[model samples]
Target: MDLMIANQKSLRNLTVLIIGAGPAGLSAAIQLERYGIDYIIIEKNKAGGLLLNAEKVVNYPGFPHGVKGTELAKLFTSQVQIRKIIKDEVIKTGYREKYFETRTKLSNYKSEYLIIASGTNPRNTNVIINKSAEKKVYYDVINLSHHKGKTFAISGSGDAAFDYALTLSKYNKVIIYNRADKIKCLKKLYDRALQDNNIKYVKNISVLKAFASGNGLALTLSNNNRIVVSYFVIAAGREPALDFINSDKELENLIKSNRLCIIGDVVNGIYRQVSIAAGQGIKAAMEIYYQLNKENN
Candidate 1:
């Protein structure tokens, strides 16, 4: 059994393979469970995806007073406990005859259908703090949430930037710098942020350099301005988390057949919301069910 599992040719008789455990992938699993579909969901890192980084989620239905991002993630995770999510990374993917093959660090698996719910990764930036001060910068606030009376310099002008500002303001001062003069975040996040005296927004500036400054970090701006802060947060932007995927012509054509479904934040662009992602997952599962049932009959 071990030898057969180790062999990449040994296939798992699963109907569909989902590559993420975020809201979209989790919802797909929940729906597929109801339909009794033989499916496997794999997640490389945390099961919650971007929501794990959120400080507070106000828009998700059910929580009257709003819920923390991590809390929502926990709730999403609870619903999918019936099946285990493969906690492994998919290094490569390809289609094998009629099966979709995915190679992970430990093993490989193939299925009749594939769902790419890998979601989005932070946008790459030319600006990288040196290794000496690497720990002083972060993409999320999980580590810095407990620190009090410290200043944080956030780089971005979107909802995430303001969201990070609001999260950090609980016990620290936050300075947000935007490359352009206009703000891209919703008016509510901006307005609510203004109510907090700890948050400050600076427009028309870019982080040119960042290095170690005492026990913190020193940032040089595009206009030759500089600021020293306890930590730096990057809320710049995000792009599809499809770097590991190859642009195969055959795979691209599979979308038309619904055999390869790409759902959630990875394809949602600016509309990356939990509810929307869940809805897309349900829609994909419904279409998949119809196709599978038609074939079985």
Candidate 2:
């Protein structure tokens, strides 16, 4: 999709640059717009980030009946139209003189301050390396509807894993696995999973090995139990997707200098939510604004 920021001004001499156009970055952009700061956003993909794939967002405030993830994303994006955008993946970012220089696949850019809200990527498992196991592993439930007739095993106990299982169980049998007896998800989700006949919970275990079987994959558990399923979904967790910055020294320098601000899910934390990300974005923008204002004065 084209990057469009409403009521946008010129970016020829912008001071701030935000990487990523997710909830955090966009929230920062909206705050910056209100403050009349000249800035631009560099996004590699669509503006929604991980929120787009969410099945339903009931926890986010202001929606009494709950809202779909895509709908919320649309509402968030409509708030601000950025002055300029570089719709390419950032390859390297480092400090150059008084500005932070960012290199992309297409060109280079420089800004006085930088905000990184690049968000996350799916965690990887080596179970799918064999060609035979290609279509048997999945990281998301976006395509679960297609496998309505097949049984699946999900490897995780958090909200995502349970949510996926609950949704998938409506059409197919689902087995949810966790390494411990205690789950980290919301109590409501955990209770719902236990009550669903089509959804089974396998606790205090881990997947030791997996191999492709006839039209499915066979997984051997830590307890030495075997279960064969048509698909395996790993919701174990996610890792920060920050392969763009090539130099550790550059990141460290930015951290020490207070020139780099990391917002949203990319930051290390126990929880991740759209509202929190948006609040962080606003906080980052305010910090930058005050920092720049102090220097100008």
Question: Which residue pairs show backbone clashes in model 1?
Answer: none
Q: Can you list the residue pairs that collide in candidate 2?
A: 5-81, 5-82, 6-81
Model 1 scores worst on lDDT over the 10 consecutive residues at 1-10
- Candidate 1 lDDT over 23-125, as tens digits, reads 9999998888888888888898888888887878888888888899889988888877645688899877777567777777876787788899999877877
Q: Give candidate 1 misplaced runs (Cα > 4 Å).
A: 1-6, 9-13
Give lDDT per model, in order.
Answer: 0.85, 0.79
Alpha-carbon TM-score of each model against the true structure:
0.90, 0.78
Residue 244 displacement (Å), model 1 = 2.2
The true-versus-predicted C-alpha distance at residue 73 of model 1, in Å, is 1.6
For candidate 1, the per-residue lDDT at 133 reads: 76
